[model samples]
Target: MITVKAPGKLYIAGEYAVVESGFPAIIVALDQFVTATISPSDTFGSIVSKQYQENSIFWRRQGDEMVFDNRDNPFHYILSAISLTENYARETGQALGVYHLGINSELDSADGKKYGLGSSAAVTVATVKALCQFYHLPMDKSKLFKLAAIAHLSVQGNGSLGDIAASVYGGWIAYHSFDRQWLHLQRQQHSLTELLAMDWPDLKIELLTPPADLRLIIGWTGSPASTSHLVDKVAMVKAKQRGEYQTFLQDSKACLKRMVQGFRNGDLATIQTELRQNRQLLQGLGDFSHVTIETPILKKMIQIAETAGAAAKTSGAGGGDCGIVLIDRAIDSTQLLKQWAHEGIQRLNLNVHTVNDDVISKA
Candidate 1:
């Protein structure tokens, strides 16, 4: 049996802007992860995920495709991962055998609420690694990131793939979005195997070492966000208002630069200033796009963090999900937690997964 683990992620800054080409976002891999275990199966392959439900999906190879026994399955990501990995193997002249797969996650609430911790990306990365191990395919982090990205984009047509990168290579990362327009056009003409084989030198993914004194607190808003819906809304706005969108992109780029510099120099004031400015920028985006990017509850949480002399902002395409707070070591964590609890924000006790740590481990 082979087991693989992938961590979920949080975007510190550059959320909507990172969707544009050449814009960079700072993301951190959380300690929480999704684990995939693969072992040999006699008749056919099966997948069981506790996070999805109590159902098991049994599937087998049908010509070149993986046909699951159930059609209306929620675990489309697992199927996509298997299908794409199979295609990759065949294209690279590798053979694969049947295996039973089990996926478990620690990135969810005890009562089954998702923390908006990029669970889908974590699972997709874990599945790709497990499939690679099952088929004895030699894959480094970069290759694994590409393969997992192919599977993710197959299921969900749009994303920056920052979560996928964070999952494959655990740590604080500065990432630039890939050329989605080019990828979309290429997908129409090429297969996933062909796309993965191509080189994408323009996609920048750099691992960063954050300041030791930097402290982070993750607070869940008890509401789930549809990232696709938000991304599409933003995309429509960009299509109609290209100049305005460019302004947002430029402003976000400047903010991200300052934030990165702040981290490097241990300048808490610069980091805090950028975080608040970026939050205001996202709020402006919500107003411009007519989509509520930041909800009232998320705003209140940020306010609470700010009152305590910390910088807070929504992590992702936030209608309502998790908000991140960055503070210095001098701040009172206990007092902050009490205030957040009063505001109905659930604090998630998670730490950053650093680059020195292993992303995939034997379970």
Candidate 2:
């Protein structure tokens, strides 16, 4: 059996702006993960996952659209991963074999509640990693990320692939998105193998060593938010306010620069200050789009953390999900977690997952 694990991620900063090419975001991979295990089968293959529900699926991409082999199957990310990996395998002249692939995740609650931990991206990365091992394909971190990003894009069709980057690299890293528009055009003229080998325009990934004194804390609001749904809402209104939106993007870029610098310099105060600025920028974005980026509960979550002398902000799209806080190690977070619990918030115990290697191949 070949097994691979991809860690879930939370955005530290640069949410909406990261979607555009060349904008930077800081993201961390959580200890929670989605694991994919595969083994060769004799007659046929099956893909099964016990997440949300137990099921399996097969699919193919028709140009930019995903065409499900089984219309009732909901696991588009896995199917897309299978399709793309097999394509890459054939392109590399590997003999494909029937395999049974199993996926299990720790990114959700035991009773099946999502915590907005970027499960889709994690699963996609996991599946791709597993298949690469299954085929004995020697893949570097860059190729794995590019392959997973293509599969992920074929399904949901939007967002910064920053979560994919975090899953691929692990630990804390700075990411800039590649232009999907450029990829779209290049797909018309290039082969899958060639595409993976080629340099991506505007895409950047750099590992960062954050301040050792800083500690990460996550608080869940107990209400899940649809990342795709919220991103759609923001995109719809973004065009109507072009000038203001441009300003928001610019400010976001500037804020991310300072925060990244703080990480490099081991300055917790600079990081905290910039995080607060990022929250305000996201709030202004929500105001113009009339999309509630921060709900009452999320706002309360941030306020509580701020009062404790830590910096806090909504993690993802933020209609209702998890909020992240960075506090100095000297400051006790016990009272902070207690206050959140009193307000019905669940404090999640997650650490920054550090990867010894981008992918582990074990049999």
Candidate 3:
């Protein structure tokens, strides 16, 4: 069996601004992961993991097409991944055989909720890699990237593609889709390890979720958003203030530069300050939030985190999933966790694992 593990990613900076402008955003692989285990078969079929009480699904390939046994909406991404893999195989003359697939993912939703931690992207990355191994496709990361991207587009309709890219390649990635390219992506396998090896600079991070008894507090603005939707929304804004957007991009880039430097130097203060400023800059974008800074529960959580000495912002597609908070110093995580629980805020302990460090592969 060929096992492929993909990590869930968190966008540290350059949220909406990276939509079309080729800005640099940093993504780190969290401990949460989805694993795909595939073995050769005369037929083609995939088992969708229902780990964490999520439903398991099965799909099979008929000739050149993949058909799902269950036509539920949750299997949409799996179907999309299968379809994309089949297309890639056909175009590349690589036959994707029938295989027995078992997937196990570490992300815990406890009460059947989504955290927007790139679970879809992880699934796509895992599927693409597993299919590549199954078909013995001799493609490099770039080719794997293409197949995964097609799968992502199939489900997401549109995306920055940063999540999948980071999952596949791992570590600090600057995915600039505007130029139709990836730039300065650290592909070294040990990059994650190297990142984690650095002495964590007195900083604390909290990954929160809702009560295990309750679904994660996922707040929706009653608005469905896609990268395309926001990119189009920002188009008019950009046309009117091209100069301002350009300046924002320039400043944001500088912020990333400084943040990285601070990280390397173990300068916690600089990192904390820069993270806060970065979030402020991101919040300036109109669609960055469903409600104002003071009203929404998510934003309120950010404020509380800040008050408790954290630099925080909503993670991924900000209509709401999880808030990524940058802690200024090490605090009693257990106490903070309890505080959040009492306030009806869910707290998840997240240790952001940067790639290029440990080598974890299931082959």
Best by TM-score: 2
User: What lDDT score belongs to each candidate, Candidate 1 first?
Assistant: 0.83, 0.90, 0.58
Give model 3's TM-score versus the native structure.
0.70
Q: Which 10 successive residues of model 3 have the least lDDT summed?
A: 208-217
For residues 1-363, what per-residue lDDT tens digits would candidate 2 score against the true structure?
888899999999999999999999999999999999999999989988777465444467999998654322337888999999999999989988999999999998887778999988998999999999998777888999999999988887889999999999999999999999999999889999999999999999999998989999999999988887788888998889999999999999999999999998999999999999999999999999999999999999999999999999999889998999999999988888889999999999999998886345432
Clashing pairs in 1: none
Clashing pairs in 2: none
- Candidates' TM-scores? 0.90, 0.94, 0.70
Model 2: CA > 4 A from native: 54-74, 358-363
The backbone clash count of each candidate, in order, is: 0, 0, 18
**lDDT tens readout by residue for model 3, 213-244:** 21112222222223334444565577777776
Residue 31, candidate 1: C-alpha displacement in angstroms: 0.7
| lDDT for residue 187 in candidate 1, whole number 0-100 | 72
Against the correct fold, how does model 1 do in TM-score?
Answer: 0.90
In model 3, the runs with Cα more than 4 Å from the true position are 43-47, 51-74, 87-93, 139-142, 171-178, 181-247, 287-295, 333-335, 354-363
* TM-score winner between candidates 1 and 2: 2
Query: What order do you get sorting by lDDT, best first?
Result: 2, 1, 3
